[model samples]
Target chain A: MNRHTDTPAGTELLDLPMPEPRTCPFGPAPVYDRLRAEAPVTRVACPTGLTAWLVSRYADVRDVLGDAERFSSRPGQVVHLMAHADPERPIGEGEFTRMDGPEYQRFRRHMGPEISSPRRLAKLRPLVRAVVDERIGALAAAGPPADLYQDFAIPVTTASIGGLVGVPYADRDLFHTAASGVFSDVTDQVQLAAAVRPLQGYLFELVRRRRVEPEDDALSRMVARAPSAEPPFSDVELVAMSAVMLVAGFDSTATALAHGVLALLNDPGQWARLRDDPSLVPGTVEEMVRLFGGGAGIVREATVDTEIGGRPVAKGDYVILAIQSANHDPEAFPDPGRLDVARDTEGHLGFGHGTHQCFGQQTARLELTVALEALVRRVPSLRLAAPLADVPFKTGTSVVGPERVPVTWDEILPAEGEGP
Target chain B: MRVRADTALCVSTGSCALTAPEVFDLGEDDGVVVVLVESPPDEQRETVGRAVRACPAGVLSLAP
Candidate 1:
């Protein structure tokens, strides 16, 4: 099926076969590396059974992500079932993920103030530090053989998002269960709708309470900020957004952090350089963003027949921007696979490139930087508690992480001033 | 030369502050942006440059 008709602009629309997904010893999937090295941009069959272009070139991905109008995010980004899913009842537009133009901007603006500043994020530093410290404490208490992913990273990230989204500390378990259930494909429409009902119901109550008694929290602020309209969330939006915040804030950062630490650990020299200079943490974080390769791709469905990467994509086709592959594109970064903590990763599309670039990035950065720095400093002698091969690497469908990163240290007792 | 933020346009994402904390600070409540000094330490020029590049909303500039 390599034959293709010429576009009106006279560009050739060559049919490119989708490369098989990449898996290698060095971590990143092979499809990405192969695309970056060989094809960059090619056509692929999406999970939704639609054939569309997958842009892997760094410049191309950034260009698409930046031009939000051309590559609309509203086009059923999530799996159709997931997007149409109703936790209570299969419903209409759920939240910002699938929204565009006015409505997207409206809700985005309402929530912007909370996540826009270092100051806003700084407020959560103490809480994040506490979570980090607690995780470290648990890891230490459990002894050398501990899965860092479970014992440390996941919990810290979940707790941090829980705190930020105004999930009462006591009800975090409920939030976690519901969040996980919502993402997992346990059922068609019924299970998700049922799971979401309780979670959204709680958020509704929380929003109502916040409206009457505004707290110094994001939920309260967003409640006050969202324009008074016909459906001022109707308790539904509040709950939905709250759950969205938890999933968005928690999983993305958590996965990034886990993979980042794993990358550093695998590379001794990079780890040493970062540990030696705490000042390098910022650069290190960007490199991690480049390497973590968070979302595989941002999926967008076509509104009208259009040409992408010189290929004719008919209306209703889904376009997937291979973000992870693009980040590794050699044209974008010199020696892309080399874990240079000092690499200028300014344009890396890890947290995404443009307007829809993660709203919680600042928060993610704070969590990762602080957590990584503390781990490096405190666990100076930290090493993998189990063989890399034996470790259950987090993989397959959706988010990727180490199911458990078991680590060990030969009891390098804490510094005199450092408290346990 | 150093980068500074025009607080009026600043969205307060702290991309600059995170990139070069030595050269940028944010107000506690209102989220107003602040440059560290009329001129930052020379050693921080590259960091400041990165800060200028990191500002997503394009509110930061370099002063020669």
Candidate 2:
């Protein structure tokens, strides 16, 4: 049957096409581009046998995200063919991303104290900076003609996630392998689950350890609050939350840093401005977040059939909230194609909008700021080692970033008076 | 006239503090949100708004 065809009232539902991969490595998706231009909200078939309303306009996407009552995050609402296969199991209890209402709030509460307050984030800044410096130092020492993604991005991400999860640095290789398996797209559902289960097991063990001996990290604090009295999360919940934090914390920053560096090298004006004034690092980081557009959309499922943007969405429809696309909508951002570090980007949806916005944003910001600052300061002459298009990008997944970004720069030695 | 933050809603992403440090400041201890200036200088309006828009939370606002 021809899918996705009806308005909220009676207008014929236009079959919206997908857009080119604006941020993905797999070239452009014209279906979405057509929809964005012609039908702000249109219906389309998902990979699964269901149809969904695609909200492309900036304002509409924001409206949907802000009004969670209309849109629910429950896993059962829409079948995430990729998330789970059995339909019976459907992921796990710690899948907080799929939670709504009081459940979401409670899970968020557990995480709130960990990342929300600036003081907690400040404690993380030094560690993040050290990771950034270590990665950059390794890259610099390796000399030019190095893929920044491998030498810098991977190491920093590994270190940052390990530090946050209170894992020893020595254990990072195991965690990194587990992470790759969980997030890998090449693998089938069972394989992916196999990868995730082990990591989940590790996190549960970590939570159990923290319960007995509270440490100075997020895990301990979470366990200390769990004390088997309050709205307590089980051992599984704690571990799942930690795993989520680790994955979300590490992947997003690494992707953004890898892409952000490439974007800066391509645009010399921004690089010069940032190089000249190190103070702009933080603001520049925000602008970069807006521009990278990784994991371009957040999928939301309608709890009941509802009218959205004048389109009739069936109950359990997959509503793709195109955060990255909206951020670049012409109406919200004039000439959205341009990347201006100093632009007034107060409305961009990079970290998302409303209650479900990223909890680790503050930490993400600190990490990116430090990484960028160190990069520009240490490597003034940094440039692409190969043609921009030739750079390989991460493939077949929601999160978009360069898999290998080769960079070259003229070597500059410290002044003779500087300590070696 | 752009780049205003609601003290109650501000989660301290530091977009404002980073965009216009002259106008925004964070608590030293917990980094709870605070305003160094209710109104930023005219010259910084656009950049400040950029800061506001960059906020992950909708805590920042702007004036036309």
Candidate 3:
């Protein structure tokens, strides 16, 4: 009994794969351009063998992601790759990501201040900068032809996020190993369970520890603040919150950093421009995010029969908001295919929209800015060691990035003030 | 242009601040949008407009 055949009457189904593998690393599957041109909101066969309404246009995608009332983020309600395979439990259970209305608001209210506060994130900048510098220093010592994705982006992102979340440096590898699988393309029930179990156990223990002896990190602050909320969070809920934060923090930023490097490396002129002017780092980061930010798309379930881009959507129908397509929509952005660091990326859906917009976006931006500035300043001659087409890209993952960005440079520049 | 933010609707994604740092910021206590410039000079109007449009939550609006 294939779920694809179970679509309600009056809905049209088109055979289109979700998370459509990219032929070009910088853009989404070419099919999205066709969809945006013709059927902006049409039923399509998801990769999981279920049928979902794939929303492609910029305005339509925003409308779906933004209207939590009309569209629900609850697990089974919004079917994605993994959720389609396993609908018994909510994805990111107890995490605000799956919650709606007051329940979501409650959890977000408690967790928001700890991670998203400008003051808290501002204080993290120097520490983040130090991490970037230390990582770059190691890369310099290792010489050129290093995988920036693995050696540089992964470590800096994991360490900075781990530090904030109170994940012990000793347990960092174990934490990352377990957390990384949570976003993998794996959809088998047993395989998914196996991937998530260790992470769940680790976070449960960490939450218990934070409860007893709190630290200055985000986890401790969340624990301390949880009890004061209108409807206090349970231990299990807090554990889930930590798990969500850890995965979200590490995976998205790591991908962005790695992909940002790949984007810059692809355009030597842009790379040179950035190297010449460090002030462009912030705008460059935004541009990279707009151009290269990857996710299958935002998923939402129709809570009530609604109209998306003037197309009727029935209640309980799954809607996949193709964010990458929307970000690259020619309507919203002129010459959307081109990467312009100086382009005003205002209103890009990279961080998403509405109440569900990424709360930690500022933190991600800060990390990217500091890291890119440091890389260009330290190694202005850095270029891809391998041909761009030869580089492997990660598939079957919610967020996409280079498997390894093998980059090389001419001469290793000495640390500032060090004798030659 | 007079700029006002509907604090009730603000999600504090900080897009406005990132778009126009001189005109907007997030509150220290609640992390909601804070309007730093009520009336912007001509020089800052375009950036402020971008900031208003960049706001995901539709909290920012301009009045003549």
Candidate 4:
């Protein structure tokens, strides 16, 4: 939805939507299947007029993502939801995801130790479980037929992220609102502005508060490190980092939880299997990550001319790695459409493959595991309130899934402290 | 199976330690790879292989 101002004259390019539209709720857009088979490395246009070689074969996708030097992790390649920042300026330090080489490693040295540290995640598990229980309790109290997407999935993810990043309890609404606006549509200018402007002001204020008073949370840990570190982290950079934690991390897990639950409810045997055997939760979470990778494409720009799946890709050509399609590739995943919760889903590009793979993937797996285990345990007879076709899905965006899931249950289980 | 990890290459994604804690761990100071057991039991081999494959940095390995 950017202005598409850079379109070149002469030849035409296909302006395919990044997430595209899904013919089946459970699979990626059908076009990807054909693209993988017919033209695994084919050119497609982004909203910004950059023509990219959309790579669909699992092996090619893996190679492109895994080779950091050959394929750069620059920022412009993203099929972005938010309005673009100035493209001319140098990528400041601490903007780690888009950075490559030593600069990327520098941020990782500071952040990797904090966010996914063994000690931090141990404390995080119970907090996430508590959030899951609280949301489920509220959902049960509200209705036998409840809207899971709005009422359950969104709140749980928003609250957990708020707690993870040390955002105050009162400001979680602002976080949730901004996430909703950005995920809904890129074309809607009013919603885009509302999502962007307020969050910037609020994050700066939050960072200032963390400066004076550090807490046992990810942001505070970074802030505590900032003052002592070499070439210290600027407050603006900290704000940008926090925004990514809240907003980028927000919808990924929510959609996984929402879509996983929705899909499970539709498959009664699978739902019952999970409820009966809690030990399967880990593998089920992996399956959820596989099917609902939460992204359609993860883009990269080639550093030099290279061949992918036998097709020649030119230097500076953007390669759109189809994460969702790669997960469903028959070469990688046998019986790709079938949801086998116990399937060996390792090496799937669900969290992405390498270099810039998801920093919070382990936490996301833990979150999905705890949430799914709790839901299946608390509401054994849970089922969908509406038909699968009737459900509204998020389209034309990176993090894609069902927007709303109306669910119903026969009986709700009480919280541990509450009487049966 | 003998598990090997290169801490210098470890980015601390924690996939190895989380998947096969019996074989690997993260350093308390810097959160890099730390191998707990060089040769794991036959019972531990499967998870250890998973740990090796799951390491984002491709630093974890095992002797055949």
Considering every candidate listed, which one attains the maximal lDDT?
3
Candidate 3 residues A1-420, lDDT tens each? 243346657666887544433466888778888889988988888666666788888999888777888988774422466532543365554757777766676666566566665567778888788888788779878877899888999889888888888886577766566555666656565665676778788888888888899888888888877786667778888887777777778768988988888888989999888888888889999898888664567677778877898887777677888888999999999999788878888778888787787767877888888888888888888899988888888876777778888899887565556555
User: Cα lDDT of all candidates, in order?
Assistant: 0.67, 0.68, 0.77, 0.75
Give me the iRMSD of candidate 2, please.
5.1
> Residue A370: error of model 1 in Å?
0.9
What TM-score does chain A reach in every model?
A: 0.86, 0.88, 0.93, 0.90
Listed in order, each prediction's TM-score against the native is 0.82, 0.81, 0.90, 0.90
Listed in order, the DockQ scores are: 0.25, 0.18, 0.43, 0.55
Ranking by DockQ: 4, 3, 1, 2
Question: Each prediction's Cα RMSD?
Answer: 5.1, 5.1, 2.9, 3.4
Give lDDT tens digits, candidate 2, residues A1-420. 232323345444544333343344322243545567888786555544445576878889888887667787654322422443222345467777777665666666566656655556668878887777666667667778898887887778778767876887786655666567655535566776776776777777888888888898888887777754246778878887788777666776888888888887877898898889878888778777776653446667676778777767776566777666677677888866666777776666788776577767777887788788877777778888987778777664556778888889896434223455
For candidate 4, list the clashing residue pairs, or say none. Answer: none
Ranking by lDDT: 3, 4, 2, 1
Off by over 4 Å in 4: A1-22, A80-89, A180-194, A228-231, B38-43
| Candidate 1 stretches greater than 4 Å from native | A1-22, A25-27, A80-94, A185-187, A227-234, A303-306, A412-420, B1-52, B55-64
Q: For model 4, state the Cα shift of residue A89 in Å.
A: 6.0
lDDT, candidate 1, A281-359, per-residue tens: 8779888888766454677656677776665666655567877677777888878777888888877888775557676
Best by DockQ: 4
lDDT of 1 by residue, B2-48 (tens): 55666645544566766777778765444446777758878877888
DockQ of 2: 0.18
Per-residue lDDT for A194 in model 3?
73
Residue A325 in model 1: lDDT: 71
Q: What would the TM-score be for candidate 2 when compared with the true structure?
A: 0.81
Cα lDDT for residue A93, candidate 3: 49
The docking category that best describes candidate 2 is: incorrect
